[model samples]
Target: MVQYPFCALLMLSLLIFLATIPNAFFTQACLTTGYLRADAYQTRCPGVEAIVFAGVEQAVADDPRMAASLLRLHFHDCFVNGCDASVLLDDTLTFEGEKTAAPNLNSLRGFEVIDAIKSELEFACPETVSCADILAIAARDSVVLSGGPTWQVLMGRRDSLFANKGLANKNIPAPNSDVATLVSKFQNVGLSQKDMVALSGGHTIGKARCSTFSTRLKGSSSSDSPGLDKDFLASLQQLCSEFDNNNMTLAELDFVTPATFDNQYYTNLLSGEGLLASDQALVAEDGIATRNLVETYAEDPQAFFEDFKTSMVKMGSLKPLTGKSGQIRHNCRIMN
Candidate 1:
């Protein structure tokens, strides 16, 4: 009877040990593929997104020439999936909206930085890291360089092999899109109108090209222009005039949250101080959807983070390659 008890105890111990292996393995795998590491801070909060922003920010700080490519990586990663690193490619396949070059200078600058960062990292880490991961790293670098907060990011996303230029144009919300049109665009991507309003908060930091916001500055369409606040309209008109002669002063979309990733963007909308008509459109019409989302995001940054995360996941999934069609890119600029 004592022998039997000993055997039973050994068997139970073995079972417990076996069960813990997977968890241990999971933690180990996550150590490399997960967690954000930058400066003195190391965490996994914002996951891949934070790494990408920080990486690019750092790259730019090291070499201003890398800013454009890093910015491109940032935009692509954010649009496809909340910075999941799907835009990176291995030998397998590519994701949708993966074009050879950015359609415009703004995009071109961003993509160039991405290319430079990829090259620099490949020299340091070799094949151990993927382009997608580089994107996360670069994003962090970019933000920090621009004097923005460094967010936490998770990792472990696979790379894509293909690029879809057509889809890129179709999906990315244009600066001129009206509120309803913006709502539909977000809806098609599994986001709600409220989500659209919330994501627009990103405009807080980025500068809009003269062409993107020129319509607002021109007061082109009276129907839309009338909706803008009178004093704001005059300011926009003057700014547009200046931009017409000088492309450099293309005007900021959100003067308040221009750099910080906070709720001040929504507060601007509530006060009739929004920079873009599309932004103001959120509050100009309709029921509580706009106000509710703005208030929610304004009051609870965590809620905004949650919704933003969900929306980013949906955005990333816009048109991914599964079951093999594209290849993981060795070079994000050119196909492998």
Candidate 2:
């Protein structure tokens, strides 16, 4: 009986020893398959996150809009090809790039900022860092700088050599998409409806062009159509009226706090002041679950921040290239 107890204690001791192994060992093993981890660059490029954050902070200081722009860049990059930084590619004579995609052309900004960050990293760490990882880090910093929650971003993502303008156009959700369409698109990428609602909160800091939501002002012929507030619709019509040269005219997604990342977006939706059809669709009568989510977020900013961080991390993890699967480009805009 004493021998059996001693054997049981010995087995327990062995289990404890195994549990004490550093997580980096397991992370390194998973890296071969492109698995992302918080400390993927801790040894390879010691201060990569700080370097990227400094660049982002400087850019945002120069142009507050850059915070939103950087956030949107990561979204566009991930939605199309799984955050591979393919969206950063410039069109070459041989191949068209995603920059001119229907969803991104003239809409996506902040490429120069990303290029600057990549140049700095190339100087500091040479080819040790990846543009894909830079984008993920910049996005998290942008949110934090804009008064949002901060989360540890998974690194070790690799950049793609090719760009897909077609997939970008198809994958990036339209500003006019309804809740159901938005939910379906998110579901296609392994995200749930709740994730869709939470991620859409990103609009809290961005701007949209008149062309993105002018259809709402055009007025529907059907009486049962969900209508925007008359005053809000009138303002949008006036803002979008100069259609000839006003295509580039900008409107804040969340007018209440255009430069801050917060829950005012959901509150705007409740007041019928949502800038995009998709934004309004979240709180529409037809979307019970989504509307409930909007209500929850509107009533609780902390909940929105927590969920947004989780969803952003989830979004960033999609189909990344790692461990010799893709190259780390010298220039973010060109293949090296």
Q: Where does model 1 exceed 4 Å of error? A: 2-55, 59-108, 140-152, 220-224, 243-249, 298-328
lDDT for 336 (candidate 1)? 55
Best TM-score goes to which candidate?
2
TM-score of each: 0.68, 0.90
Model 2 ranges with Cα > 4 A deviation: 1-30, 220-225, 242-244
Clashes of each: 66, 0
For model 2, name the residue pairs that clash.
none
* Residue 229 accuracy (lDDT) in model 2: 69
Q: Tens digit of lDDT per residue, candidate 2, span 206-314?
A: 8998878866767733222364666777787778786567566788999899999999999999888889899989988789999999999999999999999999999
lDDT of 2 at 257: 93
lDDT of 1 by residue, 172-265 (tens): 6666567777788777667777668756765555555555556665554444564566676677677766644554565666665564555676
lDDT of 1 at 223: 49
TM-score of 2: 0.90
